[model samples]
Target: MRKLVMVSMLIGLGVLPACTRTTNTMGYIVDEVLVAEVKPGIDNRASVEKALGKPSIAGQWDDKTWYYVSRNTKQTAFLMPKPTEQSIIAVSFDAKGNVASVNRRGLEQVANVDPVNDKTPTLGRETGVLEDLFGNIGRFGSAGSAGGPPQ
Candidate 1:
């Protein structure tokens, strides 16, 4: 009985780790006070960078906008991570390099996208396995033909 109880306790201890959830923070770590201090017109690229650090991503089309993204996710063993909190701060700069606008967004902007089927549908003639193997057999050429052995 004592041996059985010891084995059970060992098994329980091993399984405890798998039952616990893991939390992960991805992208820039946001500091609310610093973010709040960044003011439009007063703060410029250099000040913003000093306060908030470098941005997570810059504007794709132009260098006028900077984005700071943060996300917190919780995941279980062998399971996909689920976002619990998300924040995005977009700072737009004017031609003079001063901050033009500062915008903050939350989890409401997050979108769930589902991909299509695994096999991508392509534009072409569909052939069977046998057709693929023997398709080129006869097409090679016959005697005296361009592709055939010379007579």
Candidate 2:
């Protein structure tokens, strides 16, 4: 009986490591060699696409700028994934479609945003729960109250 308990303990110990935090790579996988080949004034939109594939995201207002973003995140069990590393390559295009500039950014640019909780303030008078439940009562006129429509 002791040997059986020992063997089960050993198996549990071996399985514990499998539950450790896992690292995930999300978004574009950048290749330094391909990125180096993209030169301003030489590479156009078509050439850049061929070299780097489709960008992770583009300028929201226009197509003049493209961004290749890569991030590594680590998560444990059911917790939210936290960023371990992040990289962004922004390529801007001139009006003629040629590459105007290439900029590289790292994790320092990331912003942490915490949204406001609870009720959202709106332009209206506050009312209790009971008022909300019966507020619409008697709001509509009776069908006979209109008398005889337009004379």
Candidate 3:
């Protein structure tokens, strides 16, 4: 009787994990939403709003840009364990508010860009960490300073 009860309990416990195991869907659905509804060369502010829905991001620089984005995400495991599906629709307007460019960006074609490009000059910096932190390599020679004679 003891052996049978112990076997049954172990079997029941084994089944519990299978029942509880679930996958966290870490992705969003980007349906067939209108990418750029504004007319490529004729649409103005009012015309653009009439064609497409409200933009996810909209502002003006030298030119005006409207961005429409959709995403579905799931984070099932540790940091950045799941995947995401996303889309970005961008529309640009000329100074006169005529649509200049309409571009579609999918997950595979997009790249994250840093606002400031930190580039090293060709002259190059000092090699060693100590040299970079403590002035030039010749600084060590000036240790016995005050214009004193060398040892």
Candidate 4:
């Protein structure tokens, strides 16, 4: 009975860490109730800011667009986190600063961006290890020989 209990305890301890799920949330936290209060063509930037606080990102070139991005990811143990939910609230303003459009998107709109794997092509020729070590040896002549004698 003692051995059985010890084995069970050990198994439980091993499984506990594996079963743990860690959830990570980034960017804005949206509330449907607050979002409903915003009305396009009426709510200006100030009102929008007041209602939604601040956006996660603004347009790079101009301030006409605002983005409120949110993502929820979960990971078990040492596994890479996977996005379980994603939300993006895009609000655009016209020249007058009034909200022109309010759009919302979900995980379906998320794009998988695969970064380029190839290294950048440099202009210079690649030198080998030995060339790098001994390349500069004879360039400057002997170390002691200076312009005339040392002062």
Top TM-score: which candidate number? Answer: 1
Sort the predicted structures by TM-score, highest score first.
1, 2, 4, 3
Candidate 1 lDDT over 29-130, as tens digits, reads: 989999999999899999999999889999999989999999999999889888999999999999999999999998998888776886677899998999
| Model 4 TM-score, all chains together | 0.68
Using TM-score as the yardstick, the better of models 3 and 4 is 4
Winner by lDDT between candidate 4 and candidate 3? 4
lDDT by residue for model 3 (38-142), tens: 558877766766667567778654438887776645553344423356667777888888888878786775456555558544675546776668765454546
lDDT of 2 by residue, 21-86 (tens): 999999999899999999999999999999999999999999999999999999986788888899
Q: In terms of TM-score, which candidate is stronger, 1 or 4? A: 1
Q: Which regions of candidate 1 deviate over 4 angstroms?
A: 1-9, 119-151
Indicate whether candidate 2 or candidate 3 has the larger TM-score: 2
- Which has the higher lDDT value, candidate number 1 or candidate number 3? 1
Model 2 stretches with alpha carbons more than 4 Å out: 1-18, 116-151
lDDT of 4 by residue, 1-151 (tens): 9999999999999889877999999989999888888898789999999999899999999999999999999999898788999999999999999999999999998778665766665798999999999997656645457643353
- Ranked by lDDT, top first: 1, 2, 4, 3
Clashing pairs in 4: none
Candidate 1 yields a Cα-based lDDT of 0.94
TM-score of each: 0.71, 0.69, 0.47, 0.68
